[model samples]
Each structure stands twice: as structure tokens, then as C-alpha cells.
Target: MIDIKNVNKFYGQGDSSFHVLHDINLSISEGEFVSIMGQSGSGKSTLINIIGFLDDEFKGEYFYYNHPIHEYTRTQFSKLRNQNVGFVFQNFKLINTLTVADNVGLPLLYAGEKRKAIKEQVKDVLEAVGLPDASEKKPTNLSGGQQQRVSIARAIVTNPQFLIADEPTGALDSKTSREIMTLFKELNQKNKTTIIMVTHDEKVALQSERIIQILDGRILSDKKVNA
Candidate 1:
């Protein structure tokens, strides 16, 4: 569902330039689960940001479902992300004062869905994430894993076609991380949601169907995992 070719990203002007991505070429099919793994400053997250249409200042051609992202306007990108993409960050990014249902309904509310529809969507996503009764709880009341689950619920409430997660399990313990990863796996398999995750953990990388290894702003390798 994504095609990127000869992509390069730089920060700063001529003499003060720092290149973050180098001639990156990537293609991901719909319903695929993939991981981008690298050390700090290795450009994994940068690449994801580009793919997610959050940053389009790089030099290259990006095609999402055959539409050229480089030609899309800022408002177009915003609408694309809202309609088709979901993002999960290492930080939950939830408002402390908002209830779980409210936090999950933010995207829908922004899309101008009616209150009754928003409430139903929130309930469905929360239940899908295995948090059926979490609608009324504040984020602070939940544990780290539960909060992350709520974050996941929030992301999928719109039923996005693509899910981009940046260090999604970074804040959780091993068991909790595994649980979260398994939840992602189920989402990919059952819902056919394409997932592109950025992570430093080999174990987490292994959970994906494809692993992309990056270093020094370039892709070192891209390979599939055995069942």
C-alpha cells in the first residue's frame, strides 16, 4: 500500500547539513506487518514519519495507494491521515482529564461524527482491545499496559487501514510487551490492518512478518520471517 523510492531527508542548509535518510527505497503491501529496527538516530522513526505523511519535506517520490504524497497539500495530508492512518507513540499521548472513551473518540469527534455514533465506535474499539469496561476510567487509573491498550483502542477507533506505531512497547515490561504485540498481531491478521512499527527490540522486531534493518540512514537488509 506504500511505495517510496530514492528518498533522502536532510536537516539544515548546505554547510550545516545533517542527512537523516539516504536513498531509502521501500514497498509494503496491504495487510502486511512490518518492523523497522535501528539504533538511535538511525532514521527508523524518520522513515515512519515520512510514510505516515506526518513529514513531507524530504526529497523523493512517495506513493500511497497510487497517489503521490509529494503532490498532496497539507490539508490533504491531514485528511488522509485522519481517514486512513492510525498512529501510536511510546508516550500514550492521552489527555489526563479525559475519560478513556473520550480520548478514544477524539478522532471521530474531529471528523464530525454524531455523539451517538462516536460513543458506539469508542465502545467497539475498547472492547476489541480487551478493555470492555474501561470507558469510564481516567488514564491515570490504568496501569502502563492498560494505558497502552487504551492508546491502541484510541488509534483503531476510526478503523484505519494503516497503523503506524513508534516504539509502541517501549514503556512496558516483557510480559506486557508481549501481550501488546500479540494484540497487534491479532489486529493485523483478523482485521487485515497493515502495520509498520519502529522499534529497537529484536524480540519485538521478530514478531512482525517482515523485519527491516536500518543503520547510518540506510536500509541494511529487509527480509521475511518464517512461520
Candidate 2:
């Protein structure tokens, strides 16, 4: 579903140049659940941003589906990202003022969807993430796990083909982290949503089907987990 080849990212030009990624080549298949692991300053997040199309100022080719990504206009890029990709950040990016339902339905609002349809889709996703009763509540009222679930629901409500989670469980406790991982597994199995997550936790990484470890702006290892 996504292919990145010979991608290199530099932070600045000339004397300030700091390479964040080095000829990184990666391909994520449809319905694949992949985890990325790396230490501090290892360029994992940089690569994630590149793959997510948030950092377009990189060096190399990124092909989404079949078309070259850079060829798309800003409006077209926005639409494709909205339609195909969803993101969950380390810090839950939910608006403090909006209700959970409102936050989850935000993406659909941008798509110009009908309110009734948006409500239905939001409710379904909330239920899928095991937060049916919390939709009317605000993010501040929910626990860490619930907030992350809200973030997840918000990401998947549009039925996006890909979900990119960066340190999704960084703020949660062990039990909550496990619950979120279980929820992710169920989503992957049931809906076939392609998932790519970046994490520093070993147990969390193990939940994924495959893990790729990065270091010094390059891939160090890639391995499949035992079922």
C-alpha cells in the first residue's frame, strides 16, 4: 500500500545539515501490522513522518498505491491523507473543548459529510474501540487508556486504509497499554486496516506481526514475531 525508496532527509543545508534518514527503503503491504523500534535520535519518527506524507521535503521517491506522491497537489494530498491514512500521536491531540464524539467525528466534518451519517460512523467507531458510553464526555474526563481509545476511534472513523500510531501507549499504565494493544489486534484482524506504529517498548512491539529496528538513520533489523 505504501512504498518509500532511497529516501533521505536532512534538517538543514550546508554547515547546518543534519541527516535524519539515510536511503531508507520500506514497503508496507495491505493489512500489515508493523512496528518500528529505535533508540533516541535514531530517526524513527523522521521516517514515520516521511511515510505519513507530513514531511514532503525529503530526498527520494514515495509511491502511494501506484502514483508518485510528490505529483499530487496540496488539496489532492490532503484528500488522500484524509481518505487513506489516520494518525495517533504520543500526546492525544484531542481538543479539550470538544466532546469525544465531536473529536472523533472531526475528520468526517472536513469531508463535508452529513451530520446524521457522521454521528452514525462516530458511534460505530467509538463502540469498536470499546468507548460507546464515553462519546458524549470530553477528553479530560476520560482516563489515559480511554483517551488513547478516543484517539484511535478518531483515526479509524473514516475507515482509513492505514493507521500510523507514534508512541500511542507512552502515557498509559501497563494494564491500559495491554488493553489498547488487544484493541489494536482486534481491529487489524477484523477490519484489515494496515497499521504502522513506532514504539520504544518491547512488549508493545511484540504485539505487532513484524518489527523493524532502526539505528543511525538506517534499518538495523526486521523480523516477524512468532504467533
Q: Kindly provide the TM-score of model 1 when superposed on the true structure, using C-alpha atoms.
A: 0.97
For all candidates in order, the CA lDDT equals: 0.93, 0.90
What tens-digit string does per-residue lDDT give for candidate 1 at 2-50?
A: 9999999998889999999999999999999999999999999999999
The residue pairs that clash in candidate 2, if any, are none
Candidate 2: tens digits of C-alpha lDDT, residues 1-227: 78889999999899989998999998989999999999989999999887877777888999998789966677887787788889998888999899999999998988889777788889888998999899889899998889999999999988898999999999899999999999888889998989999999999999999999999999999889888
Worst 10 residues of 1 by lDDT: 109-118
lDDT of 1 at 180: 97
Model 1 residue 145 lDDT score: 94
TM-score, candidate 2, is 0.97
- Measured against the true structure, the TM-scores of the candidates, in listed sequence, are 0.97, 0.97
Global CA lDDT of candidate 1, please? 0.93
| Clash count of each predicted structure | 0, 0
CA deviation > 4 Å runs, candidate 2: none
